[model samples]
Target: MKNTRIKNIIFDLGDVILNIDVPVASQSFAELSGREQSEILAIFNENEIFRQFETGSMDEAGFRNFIREILEFDDLSDEAIDTAWNSLLLDLPPERVELLKNLGTQYRLFLLSNTSSIHITQVNKILEASTGVKKLQDLFETVFLSYEMGVMKPDPLIYQKVLAQAGIKADETLFLDDNYDNIQAAAKLGIEVIHVQKPTTILEYLKDYAV
Candidate 1:
């Protein structure tokens, strides 16, 4: 049976829908800063620096500076660092945007992403430049960016914030994210969560409850 219990659909921007080459970013950092990718990623994954950056405690420049300091790469210029940082960006599929638009005819679609200013700026540029897809801004009813909102996923507060903003019961919401922890976090609050892997396209998932 269709999960008619679902009323709101929340999406994670990176990896879930939009393809992100996280390894590209890590490789760039390693190449520029002379640190091993594992070491740099260890720092990033351990410190939740990305989460802090997303939650607005650190601006793009500040985050870059912090990383530079951490790696002790005094030789790298700011622009170089920015370039390395942004190398993770990849194209968003036009088909997914169209699917989301179709789903919006029924469900309350929202984007809740743990993204910072640097990444978002790049994303907006890509959306504007895309030829086939509806602009990312136009595909959803609301886009709740973590940097702008000062909250990030896997943190329960962000989920509560999205639920309150959408004015829906947690049981009525379905959250799609690539991160297991983020999915589990939302599940804790009663959201029907999907941990997307591959082949199981979101369109297939939406067909169940889509009107």
Candidate 2:
């Protein structure tokens, strides 16, 4: 049975609902810049530009320029950079879409993602193409994006802001995320959390509630 006390659900975008393959994007960037995939992946993990971009401290043009500079390919076009950056995004499974549709009818559903604008646009496209859902926002009550919010998960302020803006109490909400740090952070704030591990999905975790 569903938890009667839980009034809202906050969902992490990557891995929880949308499938993403980081190494694919790393390979794409490597191919474009003639760099090793490992090097590209390392840059993504360590680069300040990536964090800045996700936090809204950097604009698209600035982020593109930074990518070109880091990749040492000054001639890379905007389309090429965006394509490589968005390559990490995969399809939103139809089953997950249906789960969201069913859950939204019961509890208040919200999407919280530590993602970039370039990726979000591509994700929406993938969601539309895969499930006939026009936009991701249509599946949730509200979408909280790192790039748009200027804050990312693992930060208490982001969760606090979501709770404040949604007018929901932390103890009355449930959060599901693939990242352990994010799960811990939300749990610390008294919001119940489920670590949506690999090979198991929100569909598997909340199958009972979907009906």
Candidate 3:
């Protein structure tokens, strides 16, 4: 059930509103690097590559170059590296965009994502191509990216920043994301949260809070 006091909706990008092809990313990486899926994933989880990218410690080209070098690849073209890096991004559903557009009419909407420049570039290319869908930039009152913000979700500070930025009370905002740790982080901050596992579909989970 939603908090009856909710006045704003804050959304997470990836699996919440956008469909991420994790398998595509993993498989592509494995094939390109000649490493087993487990090995590649282990590096992803063990190292803070994604985290560093998000925090702007590294740029997209640098990130890709590091991956290529780590895998001992010999001078793969930047485009090829980018393709492997971007293979995970998929289109945002038109219906979901519509839902956000309609909701934007009533409540404040925000986009807070733990994503990087490379990944967001892929998302933007796909999203901008859609005509009828609400542009992600337009749907939100403000956009906060972890990379640009110097913080990531599941960190209490990020949620605090969102609330502070929106000028909304914690209890007045409903935070949505696919990651449980992030949901838990926001919950600990006294903001209401929803765990969205279904990619490209949020209306089902938002029924209780629909205005």
Instruction: Output the number of the lDDT-best candidate.
Output: 2
Clashes of 3: 1
TM-score of each: 0.88, 0.96, 0.91
Clashing pairs for model 3 are 54-147
lDDT of each: 0.82, 0.90, 0.81
Q: TM-score: which is higher, 1 or 2?
A: 2
Cα-based lDDT at residue 54, candidate 3: 85
Candidate order by TM-score, decreasing, is 2, 3, 1
Across residues 1-211, which tens digit of lDDT does each residue of candidate 3 receive?
7667878999999888888877777778898877898888878777767788888888877887777766678677788777877888876777777688788877889999998887777787777676443346767889899999898888889888888887999888888899899999999988888888753358888876566
What clash pairs does model 2 have?
none
| CA RMSD per model (angstroms) | 2.2, 1.3, 2.0
Off by over 4 Å in 3: 131-135
Q: What is the lDDT of residue 150 in candidate 3?
A: 90
Using lDDT as the yardstick, the better of models 2 and 3 is 2
For residues 1-211, write the lDDT of model 1, one tens digit per residue: 4687777889999877787888898889898877799988987888777778888998877897887778787777878887888899887766677778778888889999988888887787776666454345687888899899887779899999988887889988889998899999999999999887666767676666655
lDDT of 3 at 141: 89
lDDT of 3 at 164: 85
